[model samples]
Target: MNSRLQHLLEQWSNDQFTEADKQELIEMLRSASAEREIIPVLQDMWEKTEDEGLFSEEHQQTIIKNILDRYPAGELPDKKEIVPTMYAIHRTHFIRRWRWAVASSVALIIGIGAYYWYQHMQGKRPVDMVQSTTRVQPGQNGALLTLSNGSQVLLDTLQNGRIVLQGGVVARIRNGILLYEGTGSEVQYNTISTPKGRQFQLQLSDGTNVWLNAESSIRYPVTFAGNERLVRIIGEVFLEVAQNPSIPFRVDVNGSTWLEVLGTSFNVNAYENEGAIRTTLQEGSLRVVGDRFNGHLQKVLSPGQQALTTKGNADIRVFDDVNAASVTAWKDGVFDFNNVPLEEAMRQLARWYDIEVVYQQPVPKVQLGGTIKRSLPFADVLYFLGKVGLHYKLEGNRRLIVLP
Candidate 1:
């Protein structure tokens, strides 16, 4: 299909198509037989969209009306009995604005030569891929909570409403967010942790909001009664600190890195397996400090900056130009692997899907860039790696062996 026409179709499929655009699309669909054949594939893709909720029931009915108007009968897919082949789309100008089509950086489709594919006797294969009968589903809102007395509670299984009361604070789980009500003079500590393939959000007594990524944990007090509001975290977290000039907000990350702020929004990724702690600041100013041999190494970061502290090295480095969107993309449920090494990218996948990654040979020197919806099937994620000449296979149920 021509590029402009494809843009129009994408807009129409996203429910953002204008009346004028819809008229144009209908005329094109009626004029071209090849274009008309794509309607079935479009419908299938839309049905699998991660954001299908965006299309209300009424909007879906409208889309059906438009398709039936063109076909006159509900024989669109019947005419083309073949299932559409999937492909990986690069960051082309034509598809830059169509990220909504798929959940990830790359989208799957019927026609695209940019992706690698193999022809099979049965049908067309996008890649030499295999599917496990038991697919590992994506993670959801789940975590384990540990109270001051060491009592444990599974947050996911607990029903909403008041779940805990201690240290003059009442805790509740409302719509999947753990919330604390009422401030307290007496401080009681609590910890929340997300196991592999799970994530959760929390609202502190001070009104600060925190989102914990998979395989992550955070420890905080039930209320902010100290001179400074402090929390300790391991793994990854996106925090929006409530503004309190009287009490500066402090984050103790992995016991080595520290973040001090009056009130700001920032993300800290201190996954020990990642070999470094990265702090990306999005709003307001904050100081990132690393424990050094001499004393301390610190860098004050403004908005749009990132600080990195390598493992076994106390030296801190500041990056003025940071990809804030990509850094905190995890909180938004999208993996933005823009210029990320293959190893690093796989580490993220391993954590989210709770799969083991083993390189059968030397790792390929490949850097990938794209946005992928985290909700995509694990098989689809592997299909994307095939585009860069990297191949993988599932061993048993949870092991992924990457081959060059």
Candidate 2:
């Protein structure tokens, strides 16, 4: 494929292909159809993308060439979307402009690749790398905090920097989590909330720790007082309860589900898009509760065990797994691709690096697995994947198009 032609095709797939350029594509398709085959591999690519993968950039070129060699001889139709692109990603912050940006990024990146595949595979184009936007953006990253006295605070902004004492208290942000330390007779309560696509953590005065996941929140006091410690939440969280046999700890979520513990460690996952609320116990023992069902308690679990609660449906299921590494991979800074779907893997990529994903054809059902440096540039990551057999082409400098 001619390098310029290939770049243009990728840009087309990205929706970055302008109207005038599209007219050119129509002309090329019409002429090529009479002398060469233009069988698109988007359908094939979508079916098993998760199970199988492309080996390298060279292999991708080969696939492109093979497809181009298969187009039937005829004058092609002028400019109707012959190839299908999966624009199915939804529920993303529900904002119009962001969605458009996301859509544009995906369309241009993927469209260019699809169009290039059509022309080049037939010996009409060349393969020279082009640059476009591959850095897709994930949703919001903010937190809503509520104090014990029914007061609220937003933590997303850099307000005075140090959240030390309001009246002689000391607060710290360590390991990306907030913590408070101070000696005072009055114990003030506080809450922390995270918006969709965001996460935050905190450490309480009594040494009980908590981590708030995306679209979730937690309510606690500045200091642990009275006979026991109590807190409430509506989303996902992880807790490391301070060992206090005399004073039990409790967590209230979903207006019904509850957990009690003395000294233990566990995690919770209750994102809105996801249907279940899961608590994976890493150490110690805890009790589960629910409001939907009268007898809605789960079995006690040992280390490496978990409890799950479904939305609207009130039934807790206990599952056992000893691989703590898999559960805690995100926290430890590793992109764990353990048999993940093409869409899901791309979604994670979009979130961490702030980029968008667009499929020129349908998404393949191949399962991808591996770990890589999350900080690597999008091109380097794609290049590595191409070396591993995934076919793709870049346009401009931002879009990532999925090739068949």
lDDT for each of the candidates?
Answer: 0.71, 0.58
Model 2 poorest ten-residue lDDT run: 69-78
List, residue by residue over 1-404, the lDDT tens digit for candidate 1: 45555576566455575768745744554454743455444444444444323433344334333433222111122213212221212211222233444321112121211121222211543223343513666677899999988999998776586865665678899888999888766768999999989999999988999999999999999987759998999999999999999999999898888788998999999998898899999999998878733345788999999999976678898889898988999899888888888899999999998989999778877778766778666765665676667877777778888877
* Whole-model alpha-carbon lDDT for candidate 2: 0.58
lDDT of 2 by residue, 294-313 (tens): 65455566788777777665
Against the correct fold, how does model 1 do in TM-score?
0.71
Each prediction's number of clashing residue pairs: 7, 61
